[model samples]
Target: MTPQPGSYPGLTRRTLLVSAVAAAGTAFAGNGSATAAPALALRSGSNTLNADFAWARKRALDWVQTGKPGTIPSYWAGLTNRPAFYSRDVAHQMLGAHLLGLDAENISMLKVFATSATERRRWYPLWAFQFDGGIYRTDYKSDDNFVREVPAVFELTEKGVRQYLWTGNRAYVDDAALWKYYTNSVTYFIGAHDDNRNGVADEDGTGKIFQGVASYNENGEGLLEAGDGIASQYQALLAYSIAQQARGDEAGAQASARKAANLRAHFEKNWWSASANRYIRGFTKAGARTNFGKENSWFLPMKGLTAPGPRTDAYLDFVHKSVSDLPPFNIEAYTYLPETFFRWGRVDQAWKWFRYVADSRAAYPEVSYTTIGNIAEGLLGIEPNAPASALSTVPQLPSAVPWLELDHVPLGAHDLAVRHDGNKTSALTHHAGPRPLAWTAQFAGRYESVLVNGQRQPAKVSVVEGRTLSSVTITVAPGAKATAAV
Candidate 1:
């Protein structure tokens, strides 16, 4: 079983006290600038479910703050020791922040990092930043001295695409600095770091993090390329492709897509180990593969780079069997598990880890925010493309949650509600928006047809990430509701 926050005997109360003081001073008592309290709510038939959801939801909402008058919109995404946000943490917590109606904060913070990468720093963004937009000194002494990791660069680029998908924000494509960042992250950054010329970014292979490291696993050293780094690069290429398509750059989109395709193909051909029947985690400077597990093993599937089949299933099984052993003590690392399982359509395993992290009661800011993100993106499976005014959902509710409803979810121009009644039925309502919403209500498994508001519609069957989905698209006008059943 995963350990709870209380397991660390000396720190829980003190951490909570500090977090409360921080929240009260900035987020709750801003110069009348903080956004209104998040109206989002999660409810279920079970009392335990309600209680758990409320605990995480409230804690996450408390972290929202209008920082120190001059800072960009901010939320707690790092340790409580300082008023700063870490790149890895912020990128991971983005969905939860967006769900809380912090789109401006997301835009501000992401842009800051997006613009901070420079040629002098080899195109790596600083690892963490103070709320006031200064580089966090503790992590930076000079341009060459900061906590830089390979996965963070690509993760931020990929997450920027996530923001565009959720909000349909044109600035993601139109903004000069952000557009440059997206292009640089995949092209220039990789060019700067690929020592072996393998078309993937690599750290210097000294294994020292301050100089450069390839993976989020800081302690794993001497790695030229880590699984998480390469996997994230692949996704970043895809994200850039999506952003280019949104910008009407067909040639640019196809070029990025081809790069992404080649990267996936390369990973499929090279990373798998037939004897071990699992993906090797990383490579050393000497051209040797290492299966260090943890981030190296799980990040491949989590980033959607794995080809779905027996090999992918076996790796997920390996992850499930060894999850509790994932290290560095803090529960924040385990937060990645829920999304990893969801990527492969393993709902039971997804819920298991979701509950594990949600129930851990960890005080680290990433935990609470990620708990909410998992509810929407993992268990509920929401995919939004606001530019197109479209939304899609796949229900992954476990048996424990007979019915689940999330209300006041912010998506682009609208506030919406989504409900799942087990795996058989799902519903969405457009609460507030100028135009009607194109809702694609999706469910697991194959079906001959589906019922939309009890009217039969031809069910479209398709494979996505190796899972079969039966879906029907409908227009949900403002203040109207639509339901679909398989």
Candidate 2:
């Protein structure tokens, strides 16, 4: 289905893509030469403190230049000359690229995985992508690997659709080849890997889920099954359901959604560990629980698989307590922890973790890239729903942070600059693109009134996952600014 014109606000595909690609070319001209893009002018400070946003921005841009040309161009997992693309790493990297408005780089990475599906098998490569002329190699061995590398393909499909959502690129959504690849990949994943037929894919019974090297924590041992794999499957199924619905396949979409819901129910039943007050990491083949204290258990709340309440509260508490024990610069755990904390209303903890990582300036792409994302999408809460021509801003600015400003945030066709002062006052200046923009400002506490552009607008109050959230939506023309006060 072709989206109607003006369906997604802000930038056009040609404008965004051309400019992004041009910037990339200028930054990385010549054969595989790397240069960092200039840091974005994102500033945050208070009376007693200030943050160096430029450092994080420069590091993130530097990481993207590590992209190497191959069957499809993708950012390397690290600076090492391994010349391989790990699916999970690529997935998170692409997400960071999208948030940074690096449209060309993000699309290139997505295309690599999108086109790298095993020929005729309809599944993504196991974990790594080995480059050869135009051919890509999957790191699958019958004896050493038993669990199907489901997350890679799942993430590719999921993130592919998300790219369309963020860019409003109809041509990509309507591509017949990509649709076939994505649908077939999802079908194969369900048919081949979901051995239990319980909607969640099971390990090959060889060992822990990570035993097959299918997770971000590849070196860990034990029966580390179910936690990340199961949660990721649930997410993949939901994403597929959305993709199916978008493509006009009602039956397919419904089936996927039902399966996803079933998977979530199964996980909640089996994975919750009452004794530990958190989800068990995974189970051994002998039915014994393992890694009860591992951070993967926290992924449940991060993925929104857990319902909000006392149980969810306990889960977040578990994570909060565990943070002190976490090794410094643990990118895998940090990726979603900050966002999860902010969503759960632990704003100070979230800020603390974010600050810790920002201070480290870890050279890992996931570390630097996702940290930037946490600040923009998590702390600032600038969520762009390009499909709807509306974006949501739910700043969880910490109490100590008196002011924060993010400039030139690309939202589909528009560039948005947001400044928040005091605890509840925010000014959004929209540098209009080709279309009008609609915004929803969501505040954390109950408010007596909500003002948009100095006028009181009707505010909607709702409880989400046990937290009170208040929101107001306003439509603005090109070159207009809107101030929201709660």
Candidate 3:
């Protein structure tokens, strides 16, 4: 008998691979086969203010002339050679504005966010919107309303406006600088398309063709990016405010609409993924294109202006299918395994690899920064940013557990089979003296562990869903040293 796909209802490593590859294709056109993709998923306790995701978005936008700016990470940690924070600023500002739609007050909270720079005067002073020349039409000093960082000034206008919601500090909602910088922000798509700053023009604003060098890294390696990251970020928020204002900010809104056109054009000309039947990251002149992982969920559909249309529809398809069932709340950045494309004839083998991973994470648990924050939170923009920070302090899962501490109901995707002797378990609870969670192991057979806080106790492990070390038959391993994290 053929194994029914959704019946087992567990995440397997191979399943993850299958989903990721398939997602890349359907990223544009929905997979015709609904049987393979589950229409809905268990809405787990998740947040959008993902530390890792936030950091990634921040990397694109957070910039400070003094090098002390706080909202985005000062410098990225993992990459040996830092790329000059690239398109992250646009991503952050747009993402932040998207958050604002959910809560008006999130704007003012940004003032406290940029702790690195105490110069509120230089940034968006909270009182500006009410008193600025436009919008509320206030009479504050609008000449010196410049903020630092190209991306921040260009896209963070919504952030400043939000930040200024209560402060009445007129400087925070500075829009003059924003109006001036919007074009340069998207036009600066370097590398693949042009010798200048931007490339071809979209149907909005002035017929300004975007031009930017294909310079991805400091090392001068050209990359496949039609300014997708930057354009998507800019378009998401820009279109939103434009569409919202309608006849209000006519010129500004029109410019934003034009930028959206440009984004659409670029995607069609340079970023559509043929193999996956959807949009992928942009491509190189060499016909090579990058895969869309976690970021793609936002990057692709954001051009939709947050209204119901193809972009929104595309995003909904992804939320309902591939990512909702995968690990890390997205497909892995890129597969290390072979023949990873989903629609290929060898899909079964590729899926086998993918399912293997999903199963493993389901049984064990997650430890990485990204998986816990962004993916688990159902943050693919389905609900905006209402509960963005719920998992800011999410606890780690246990690597080794005699019994699964499933209460209420299992909130994670069914991917892995967790089998163990529950009777051997005595007590399981979070250790809070120095660490957050530490479980006492009365008896241990085999288990997976994730260290939540920095502490070692009698025996307790912390990990996210779909993870576990192969059943360890540990009659007695060395007592966990205090140095071990729970």
Candidate 4:
């Protein structure tokens, strides 16, 4: 998991004490019962599921592209400020994300790493090495050979291997070298860290969660301290837990399983708001944790990998609160917070001192964003415009562009048919409900034009998604009570 250069603050003595005590207590928290294996759901319907299918597609893609096998050329170019190419980080990210969902694309993506020589030849040892353990918050220059010296293994990469096996690619099972790295990474994710110069890399005795990794956010709010995040950890746990079962390392696997099981407890106790039902960004030694970030605190529940209970309701409420009544950018939740922090200061200065607040706000304005992985990278996946639920049925690959066929919809917003390729324009005449008298399309290059309620909305609305609203928007009429439902 990559920590942020987007700085926040350090913990005070009181907060640090709480973290210490909390970490200690959590060791005994979760139910010891072994977690059951994960399975992906059968392909359901088209893009018309009750729960916005497009949104789910975007996140699932993120989970895959970032987790395991797929090589996302874009994230490479975007983050490192270099030309895009397949890399290890994106693969592991993609792999871990799809383990539970059993998404075909995700599975297919992971299989690429496990079964294909294509991946091995392109991003091998670095990919494998990065998987087991390595920190990559920032990019490295090729001239800087020192990048090789400090590279460490990550437990997440190991956790990912367990899921990779589920793909049933026999070729993967035969590769002894790749198989060994997968197992070793799992061992490290569950065991203690070796930061303290202990002979063996097992120094997790502080009773802290997963052997702590000392880190700093240069542009940070407080001083450097501990690491935190549930998204990556949970993904890793799911992967490792299964790997242990497959490798017959029952003890090691169980221990990792317990750790994974306890994550919700750790998250809830330290980062959760019993009052709000919302999970926050990871804690510092300090008591102040923010409600938003690049990833959702509710990933455990949102994916339904595990049950959520009342916490689920509370989390949804929290999500409702954090998201704008009228969204300006269709950003996946992870990227929303920085924009808010820089702009709005929440209750009680609640988020004033947290990491990346000042910089994120200052850096992005007059401009917002869209950080998609890649159309082809399996893990750390990508969304094909407003894509259908399953890509298999669609003849063409999803694109960033959208094509709308509104004339046939009769007056239904959900029924508007769209395509990724070619220019499609059709007029829609609303039966009832207020139309947006004045409006705007949010993105730039992604779209060019869209016609609203026939009359071809005046040139005032900025062109973005070519024909449709960028990222499936919910439009409202100016100074009107009824919102334009999409």
Per-candidate TM equals: 0.91, 0.82, 0.32, 0.38
Q: Whole-model Cα lDDT per candidate?
A: 0.78, 0.59, 0.27, 0.28
Error of 3 at 92 (Å): 4.6
- In candidate 4, what are the lDDT values of residues 194-225, reduced to their tens digit? 34322122222222212222211112332111
The TM-score ranking, best first, is: 1, 2, 4, 3
Candidate 3 per-residue lDDT over residues 124-191, each given as its tens digit: 22221211112112213333332122222223433333222112222332333433223233333112
Error of 4 at 109 (Å): 10
**Error in Å for residue 241 of model 2:** 2.6
RMSD for each of the candidates: 9.9, 7.3, 19.0, 18.6
| Model 2: per-residue Cα lDDT at residue 92 | 69
* Residue 312 alpha-carbon offset, candidate 2, angstroms: 1.2
lDDT for 329 in candidate 4 is: 36
| Residue 280 displacement in candidate 2 (angstroms) | 2.8
**Once model 3 is optimally superposed onto the true structure by TM-score, how far is the C-alpha of residue 149 displaced, in angstroms?**
13
> Of the pair 1 and 3, which is ahead by TM-score?
1
Between prediction 2 and prediction 3, the one with superior lDDT is 2
Model 4 lDDT, residue 125, Cα? 26
Give the Cα error of residue 342 in candidate 4, in Å. 29
lDDT of 2 by residue, 1-486 (tens): 111111111222222223333333222121110112222457677532344366656666665543454344445554344555566776766656755656665555555556655544435444555543232334444424423354456666666665655555543455665676667666775566565566555445443432442344443443435566666666666666656655566687667767667776777788777776656666655663534334456656765667668888877777777776766545555666676676566788788877766666667666777776776776676655554455667767887776888877665566678777765877787775555676778788887679887789778886665677788878867788988988
Worst 10 residues of 4 by lDDT: 385-394
Model 2, global lDDT:
0.59
If ranked by lDDT, best first, what sequence of candidates would result? 1, 2, 4, 3
Which tens-of-lDDT digit does each residue in 1-486 have in candidate 1? Answer: 111111011122123223222322222111111135338888776676687678877888787765558777888789878778889999998888888777778878888898889999999998898888888898888998888999999999988877776776767666899999999999999999997788989987888878989988877567888999998998788778777776667687668777877888888888887776778788886664645457877898888777767878888888787775655455877889899888677988998888888778787888888888888877787876665566788888888899899998877667789999998989998887757887888888899799999999999887666677788889999999999998
